[model samples]
Target: MVPSSHFNHIRDNTDLKLELKIPELNSQFARNSHNIPPYAQNKPPKPPNLALKISMAAKTTEAPSLSFPRDIFAALSPSPFLLAHLSPQTPSTPSIRPNGRAPSEFRKPTIHRGSLTHCSGSAVVRLGDTAVVCGVRGEILLAADIPNPPSAPPQPAATDASDADADDEDDSAELSQLSLLVPNIELATGSTPTHLPGSPPSTLAQSLTARLRALLLSTRLIRARDLRILHRAPPPPDAAATPDVPPTEEAKAYWTLYIDTLFISLDGNAFDAAWAAVVVALRDTRLPRAWWDDDVEAILCSDVPAEARALRLRGLPVAASFAVFAPGGGVGDSAFRDGQEERAWVLSDPDAFEEALCPEVVTVTVDCTGGERRVRRIEKSGGSTVGRELMKGVVQRAEERWKDWLEVFGVGNS
Candidate 1:
C-alpha cells in the first residue's frame, strides 16, 4: 500500500495526455452537432426505406396471377367443388352439376345391335362415358348328359285344363333348375383403374352376373318351349294293329345360352349399362332351328339363315341409377341447405367424380313397354337418405329413362 515505485509505474501506464484531450473532444462534438443531419443526431442510422423499396419492386414485377383449372380444382376438393357448382353465389346463376347437366337429367343412351359377327348375338350400349358390349352364344345341352334330369310331364289330354296348369308349372322352373342360362361379366383392365390387367373376376363382375342370371330366371324372359328339342318316338311294329295310339314326343335336348358381357369403358352406373347391353343383345339373338336326329343319335341344326328363329322377349326393362350427395357442416356453413339440416342432391347417372363423393345409391329397373310402369328390381344401398318420397321421384325418373331407352331401340310409346 506504500509502494512509491508501483504508484509511479501505474501513473506512467495511464495516459494523462488522454485526460487532457477529453475536453477538446467534447468541444469537437458540440461543433459537429450543428452540422449533423437531423435524422443522424442522437439516434442510430435509420434503416433503408424498406417500404418504398418494396413498393418500387412490386411495381416492376406486377403481372396477372394465374388460377387453377376447373379439373384440377375438382380433383383437389371434389365435394366442395361440386357444391360450389350446385349452389351458386348469385340468384342469376343457375344451379347445375360440374358436367353442366341438371340434377335429374340423364345422359342420352346410344345402342348398336349386332356389333360382333362371330357371336350368335351382340350389342354395344353406351350411356355417357360408360360402354358395355354383350354377346350371346347358344350351345346344345343334351338331357342325357344331365346328372339329375327333371321328371317328364304326362301327356296332356286335348282339352284338359288341369294338365295345362301342370305343364305351365313345370315350364316355369325348367331354366332355373336345369341351370341352362349362364351369365358372365368381365371388367376390362383399361376400362377402369380399379380393374387391373390379369386380375381375377372382381366382386362387381360376379355380382352383376348373379343379378343378370336372377333377372333372367325371375322374369321368365326366355320360354322353355323355345329351348326344348323334341324327338318323336317311332310307332312300335304292332302299332298298325292299334290305330288309336299316337307316337310320343320326348324332350331329347335343350339349348343353353351363355350371355357374356365386357366393359369397354366404365365411368359410372356399370350395372345399368351392363343390363341394357344384355337386353339388347338377347333381343338381337337368332338361334338356328335345331332338332334331335334319331339316326345319328345327336342334335342337328339347320344351316339356312331363314331357318333361324329370334327370341321372344317378354318386356323391355330399363335401369336408372342415382346417387345422393349430402355435404357435411354446421348451419349456414354450407351453400346447400333445407329447413334445418343440410340438403341432399339426387344425381341421376352420376359420373365417376360424382360417384366418388356420393355415399347413397339407388338403382331402379322399370318396364314401361306395356303402357303401364312395372318395377322389376329396386336396389338401394349406402345410406338411408332415400325415403318414400325420394323413391317415388326415383321411379318417375326411371320411367323417363325407360322411355329414352325405347326411343334408342326405335320403339315408340304405344
Candidate 2:
C-alpha cells in the first residue's frame, strides 16, 4: 500500500479544489512519488519573498538597451532601402516640402530671455522643433594675466586718440576679452531618435563651434571695449619723480566673458538656433561691479546687484540655412534635358528628415546692425552646384528673418 505521506500536499484551497477533479491522476502521481527515493521529497519550498527578490535582482542587473521610435527605425533600419523598388506608378504631389510649405518659407521662431538666474545672461530659443539655451558669465582678470594674448605688434606711435583706441582694440581682440571662448553642443536624449544619448559631439557639432567662433570675431558682433573692466589704483610713490609730466590715472584690473551653449532639441537648423541663442544671451548679459584693493592688490567684486552693468552688443548677425532637393537625377545632371520642368527645391530651415534626404545645403549669415543689413558670411556645401543668384536670394531671406527676430526681441519694429 502506498503511503499518503508521499502525496504532494496542495496547501492552497484553489489547488486542492482543482486536484479533486482529477482524482485518478492525483492518486497515480502519489503512488509514483512513493516509489521514488526519500532524497527527492527532502526539497524545500521556494520562499515567495526570495523568489520575488531573485526576479527583482535579475531586472536590476540587466543593462538597459537603446530604444528608437518606429519612424526613426524606418529611417535608420534596412526596411526602407529594401522596399525602395516598390515605388508607386502614378506621379506624386508637386509640392516638395515635407510639411507643404513654400520653398523659401521658414518656421516661426520663439525666444525667451533670462531663463537662468545664476548666469550673467541666459536665453532659450526654439525654431520649429529645434531648441537651444545659451548662458554668458563674466570674470575679472589682470591685463598681464590674460590667456592666449595675441602677440602685440610694436606699439604704433600714439599719435592721436584714434591710435590709442586702435591699440586697445588690437590687444583686446573680441576673444581676448575672455581667456577662452568655450562652446560645446550636446545632443540631448529623447530630443530625437537619430542622436544617440551619451555620445560625443559629432563632426557637425565641431564644425558649428568653429563657425560660431569665427563669426563672433570676424563680424565683431560683441564689442571688445564693452568687455573691458577698469580698476583704479594709486600711482606708485616716487618722491615726485618726473615732475615735468602730469600725473595720469592707472588701471589695476581687467575682465572677460565665458559663453556656454547647450542644444536641447535638434531637428536641423541647429546652427540657426544656437546662433540666435548666443545673440539673445549676449544682449541680456551684465557685468558685476568690481574694484581693485590697493592693500591686497586683488580685485573685489560687489555682491550688490544694483552695481552690475549691461554689456552692449555691437551688432546682430542672423543665420539662415536652406536644403537643396533635386528630383530626376542629381543637380546639374543630363536629367534636365528636353526642357523638363525644374523639379529642384530649396527648402528653408529644413527639419531632420528633410535635411537627411536633401543632398545640398546652403547657409547664409547676415549682419542686421543699426537698421542696416549686409551679408556677413555664406556657407555652401554638397554636390549640387548653386548659382550666385540663388545665394543672393538666400541672403535676402536671411535679412528678412533678422528683421523679424529684431522686432520680436523689441530691438526694432515688426
Candidate 3:
C-alpha cells in the first residue's frame, strides 16, 4: 500500500551500495587467498602410498606367524585334528597318531603282582594312562548253607575214562550253576570325568562286572577241584581187617572267590585293563588249604604258607581292544561313492583323546598258550567298519598281545 515513488527510491539506493561493495569484496578474497597459511590451505589428499602399503603387507606375511598350540587345537577340534594326523598329506610321510603311536600299535602293559597284601591275590595293571587294581578274596561257603545244593556226581570208577570225563563235566557245570565266582567293579571318583564323587555304581561298572563273570565261566580259567574241600570219613578202628569197605569221601564246602576291580585312573580301554588285572590277580592268588571241621562244624583254612596251593589256570588269555576311526563320516554314509574307498584306521589301545573321536570299537580275547591260537571272545559295537577279514586280523593281533602278556606273566612263549 506504500507509494511507488518510495519503493523505487529504496531499490535504486540498494543497487548503488551493492555496486560499490562488489569490487572491495573481490579484492579482499584475492588478498586472503595469497596470504593464507600453508596448513590452512585446502589441498587434495595425496594418493594413498600403494608401494608403502604393499611393503607393510609383505612384511606382515613374512613375519613369524602366530598359531594355536597343538593341545589347544586338538581340544578345539578333536575330530579334524585326529583326521589330519591319521590321513597325512604326503604319501611318503609315515602316518602317526597325535600320541606318537602308529595305528594298530598297542600300548605295552605293565603289571605288578601281589600289590595288595590283605587280599588272597591282587595285581595292578597299567595300559597307557589307564590303571586298575584287582583283588581276589576267597570266602568259604559250607555245602549245608547253600539253599539248593547241586547233587553230588557219582564216584568215577578207576580206569573208566567215560566216567572220569563225565565227572570233570559235572565239576565245571557245578561251578557255573553255584555262582561261585562273583565280580564287582568300582570306578573311583576322579578316575574319569564321567564317574562323579558320591554317586552309585554306574551302568558301565555293572556291565563290566557281568562281562567279567561271563568270561571267567566261559574260559574255565580256574579248576573246580582246587576250590572243593573234601572230607573223608576214617575207617572204623577195627575195620583194617575189612579191606572190602572203602573210605567214603564227600565235598563239605566250596571256596567262593570275590573278584573286585577298582579303576584308579581311566584313560580308555577300561575293559581290557580290568580283564588283564583280573587274570593276573587270579594267577598270583594262593588259597590256603581249607578243610571241614566235623567237631566245630566250621570250615578252617590252614595258616601255614606251605600248605597253601596256587590256583591252576587253564591257559593264558589276553584281551586286546581296537577302535575304528572313519574320518569322512559315520557308518552307512556315501564314503565309498565315486571310486573313493572309505578310509578307516584300526587303532589299538586307543587313549582317551582318540577314543573320543572313534565311533566303532572291537575287543578280542585270545589264548595262544597252545600251539594254535584260540579266540575266546569277540565283542564289537558302534559301526560296520570292521568286517570278517578285519576281524581275522584283529584276532591275529590279539594273539600277539597274548604272547606279550605271557611274557609279562613270566611265562615263556609257548
Candidate 4:
C-alpha cells in the first residue's frame, strides 16, 4: 500500500485536501479497490492562465484570405475593364461614357440668326439636342405714359422731422419703374415630357427668367442708356412751326424691350442654350426711328428700312455648365488600407443621361467683351462644395468656349 507521506504537502495547502479515511471493499470489488484512490476533496481549482485563454479566444474569428499587404491586394484585384464597368458613366471614358467627347469638351452648337422675319429680332440656338428660340420687341414710352413713373414727393408735414424721411422713403418706393429689359421664359410640351400644354409656367421656367434678368442687369450686358429714345418736345400752343425755327431740346423717352425665350427641346444645358439664344437675338434687334410732330403734338415712328438702327449691346456673356460626379462615403477594407476620400470628376456640357447621374452642378458665366475675359457669375446647386481650383479651371474653359462661339457668330471682340 502507498504511504500517506506522498500527499503530506497537500495538507498544508488551502487549495487541496486529502481524504484520511478509506472504505473497506467487499469481495466482489476488492481487486479493483486499489485502482481507486481518495484524492483532494472539495478543493477549489486553480485559476486558468489568462494569456493562454486569450490566445485560444482569438482563433475563433475568421481571417482574411489574402495575406499580402492591403495596398498590393487591392491593386491586384479588380481589372481595369471591371473597374470601368463598376464606376459611374462619364463623358471621357469610351467604355461607359455615352458621348465620345473628352471630359472638358463642349458640344458644338448650331445657331440660326434672324430666323423669324416678322419679329424685330430673333434667333434659334441648338446645343446637342437642346434648342431655344429667342425674340426681342422694342416700343417707345413717354415719360408720363411709362408704368410707375418717377414723380416729386409732396412737402413733409411740419410736425416731425423723422416723418419727413419716412414720407420720402415711401415716395421713392412708389416712383420705382418697371425694368425696361423684361425677360420671359416658357417651356412648352415639346421641350420635355413633364411640361404640359396650357399648364402654368413651370417653376423651372420662372427661375430661368428671373436668373437671366438678374444676370443681364448685374453684369451690364446691355446698357440701359442705349435703349433710350429721344424726341423733341412739342411746341407750345402759341409757338409757330417754321422751318427756320431752332430745334427744341429733346425730351428723353425710354425703350421697353420685351425679350421672350422659348425652349423647343431640352436634353441638358438649358440655361446655357437659353442665354446664348438671348445674346444672339439681341444682337439681331433693330429699333425704328422716332420724331416729334409740332403740329400734332405727338411722337411719330416710321417703319422704313432706312430709318431703323441696330440696338447697341455692351458685352458678351458666355456660360459653361458642369456636372460633377463623386463616389459616396466608404472606408477601405482590410485589403485596402490606403483608402481614397471622395473622388470627383468634372464633366463639361454633359448630355441628359450624364446629367441625370450627377446631383451636383456648376454653371460659370464669363464676359469676353473688349478682348478681355471676366467671370460674371458662378452658380452652384447641390450638397457639394466646388473647390477654388475647379472654379478657375471652369472659367478658363469658358473663355475658350467664348472664343469659339464668337467665331461662329462672326463677331469681333474689339
Candidate 5:
C-alpha cells in the first residue's frame, strides 16, 4: 500500500514565525554563545557612522526600478496553471482563495509493489491526488518474424514499382498502430471533493504528461535496449507437427505490466508529484528470473536486476513553479532576500490554493548533470500585476525554488 497523502503547509503559526524571521533570531544564534565568531572580543566601542549612512540613503532612495507583470498571461500575470484547476467549492472550475494556500501542501501518496505476485516484478504507484503504477514481467523475446513462404517468386520486372509500394504500405501500417493498453492514470474516487465523470484527459493532465514524458525521455531513465526482451509466439496445439499453444488475451496473454495512476486529488502541479512517485518506485523495482524447461530444450527469461545494471538516466529534471500575489496581499522581493516582508511565499514553495490567488506565474524545468545544473526550459504565463518589480521577484523566486528542491532531494546545488 502507498502512503495516502494530503496537501498541507508549515501551517502552525510558530512555523510561520520561524520561516518569516531568521536573521533577527537573536536567540537561535545568541552572540554570547561560544559558537560566536572569534572577531567578537567582548569589547564594546563601535558606533554607526551616521554621516556615511545618510550619504548611502541619499544616493539610493529610489524604490528599486521595480519589474512586474505587464499583461494577464505575460511575465506579470498570476499563475496560469493555477487558473486551470477547480477548487472544492467549485468542482466545475478552479477558484483562487484570498489568503492563498489551501491549508494543505501535497495530497497523500500510495505505493503498491509486486501487485502481480505471479509476475516477476510489478508496482502500482499513486502520488497524493496523482496516481501511477508500473509492472515488469519476464518474457523470452522471439526472433524476428519471417514472411510466409512464397509459392513462386517470379514476379514480372514491369511490376517492380508495385512491389516497392506494397512494402512501404505495410511498414506505414505498422508504424501507425497504437497499442499502449496500459492506463497511465488512475484516480482515487476521492481525489476531488466531487466526481468529474466522463471527463477525458483534462488540458492540465495532457500538459503535465507531455512535460513528464519529456523529462523521462530526455533523461534516458530506462534505455529501450534495456527494456527489450526476446518475444516468442509459441506454436499452437492446432498444429500436429509443431506444438500449438494459444496466446493469452490482452489482459492475460503477453506479459503486460501496468502502472495505474489515479488523480483522486487535483492540485495546480500534479505532474511534479507524479514524477517523484514514479522515480521512487522505479528505484525500488526488481524483476525475478523465469526459467522454463520443455521436453527437449531449456529456456531462460532475462531478468533486469539492479546488480546487473544501474538505471541509465540522461539526468533528473526538476520543475520550479511560482505564484503572483495581488496588491492587497503581501509581495516579497524575489531578487533581494534582505527585505523583512519578502518572506511571504515568494522565494519558497506555495500550496495549490496559494497559487490561485496570485496573478502572475512562471514555471521552469532544470536538469542537473555533469557536476552542474542548467535550465532546460522557461514557461512564462500571462496575468496582470500590481507593479513591475513583482515580475522580477517571480523570476528570482523560480530559480530559488529550483535550488530548494535540489537541496531537499540531496541532488546537489544547480
Candidate 6:
C-alpha cells in the first residue's frame, strides 16, 4: 500500500539528482555517495580484504516506505530483510539462528581441499547457508617498481591484467620478491537451487577479481624490497637485473605475511568461508628463493633453492550482512540504514531469500589478526540510513560474533 502522500521523487534528468526537503529525512539521505565501487577514484584509499553484501527492502505497508541504496555495482551488495512495527511487536526471543539451533550453534562449515588442482592451492568451503571456494596461483615474474619506489621499495604487483605494464631495467639487484596473483571467482550456481546455468564464467568472477586485487594492493601486504632474490645477489650476479616482474607495488612476505587467494564458489558468507581455505592453504605454501642481477640484467636462483617465506596473515575478515524491511514510515523517518557499527538484524551471513526482502542491508567487515585474533575494519556497507537505535544493535552484535571467532580459532573448538 503506497502512502497517499507518496514521496514525489525529484531527480535531475541530466545527472539523476535527488532532492528531498524534509529536514530530518534530508539528513538521513545525505550520505557521501550512492554506492561507490571498490576502486572508485574518490573512494577511501584502503584495500579491503573482505567483500560485504547488504540487502534492503520496504514493507508492503503504504505507510510510505521505499528501499534506499539501490543499484549496487560489484563487490558488496546489501542483503535485505523485512521487519514491521505492527503496533510495535517486540518479537518473542526466537531460537538462536532461527533454525532452532541453540544460541551457541554457529554455522557448520564443510571444507573441501584441492578443489582446484589446476591452481596453486584451492579449497571449496561451505558455512551452513553460505558457501565459498578459493584458489591460489602465481607465475614467477620480475617484480614491478613503483613509479616512486619507497626507500623500502614496494612490490611491483599488477592488478588489471597479466599483460602487466612495467619497467624491469630500473630495478636494483638486491631485492627479491615474486609477484603473486590471487583471483577470486564468485559462482552464481553456489547461491540457490534455481539452476544458474553453469556458463562460461560470469560477472561475479570479474568483480571478485577486482575486489581481491584492490584489497591486496591497498593493504600493501607485500613490498618490492621484500622481494629479494636469494641467489641473484650474494657472491655472484651484478647490481642490474631485468627479471620479468609484475606491477605489484605491494609484495607480501613472512612476519607480516601475505597469501594470494582466489574465490571459486560462493554461497553466502564467502568472506568467512574463503578465509578458512585461505589460512589452511597458506600453511601449505612453500615459495622458492631467487634474485635479480642489475649489471648482467638477469635474475638468479639456487640450483637447490635456499629460503622460502610466507607471511602469517593478520587473520581473516569475517563479514556479515543483513536486511531491514519497511523502514521509517517510508514517509516520516524514511532514513535507510547503512553503516558498519549501526543497525540491527545483523546476521553472521545471509542467504538469498533473506536478501530479497530487505529495503536496507548492512555489512560489517572485521579483521581478527591478533595472535589472540583481534578485530579490524568494522566496515559498514549498506550505504543507507537506519535509526540510531537499530544501528547500535548491529555494532554491538558484530563485536560478539568477532569474539566468537576468536574462541573457535584460539581454542581449536570444533
Clash totals for all candidate models: 0, 0, 0, 0, 67, 78
167-188, model 6: which lDDT tens digit per residue? 2223322222222434455555
Q: Give the clash total for candidate 3.
A: 0
Across 222-307, the per-residue lDDT of candidate 5 in tens digits comes to: 43323323223344666676445333211111122233344646554565556654554454445344333344344454556543
With a 3 Å backbone cut-off (N, CA, C), the pairs that clash in candidate 2 are none
The alpha-carbon RMSD values of the candidates against the true structure, listed in the order shown, are 7.2, 16.7, 6.1, 16.8, 27.2, 28.8
Candidate 4 Cα errors over 4 Å, as ranges: 1-96, 147-176, 233-252, 329-341
Order of the predicted models by lDDT, top scorer first: 3, 1, 4, 2, 5, 6
Assess every candidate by TM-score.
Answer: 0.78, 0.67, 0.80, 0.65, 0.42, 0.50
lDDT of 4 by residue, 10-50 (tens): 66553332222223334536766567654533357777799
Q: In model 2, which runs have C-alpha deviations exceeding 4 angstroms? A: 1-96, 144-180, 233-254, 328-342
Q: How high is the lDDT of residue 177 in model 4?
A: 54
* Worst 10 contiguous positions by lDDT, candidate 1: 329-338
Candidate 5: TM-score? 0.42
Scanning candidate 3 in windows of ten residues, the lowest lDDT window is 154-163
Alpha-carbon shift of residue 180 in model 6 (angstroms): 4.8
Q: After superposition, how far is residue 7 of candidate 6 from its true place, in Å?
A: 90
Candidate 2 has what TM-score? Answer: 0.67
Model 4 per-residue lDDT at 390: 77
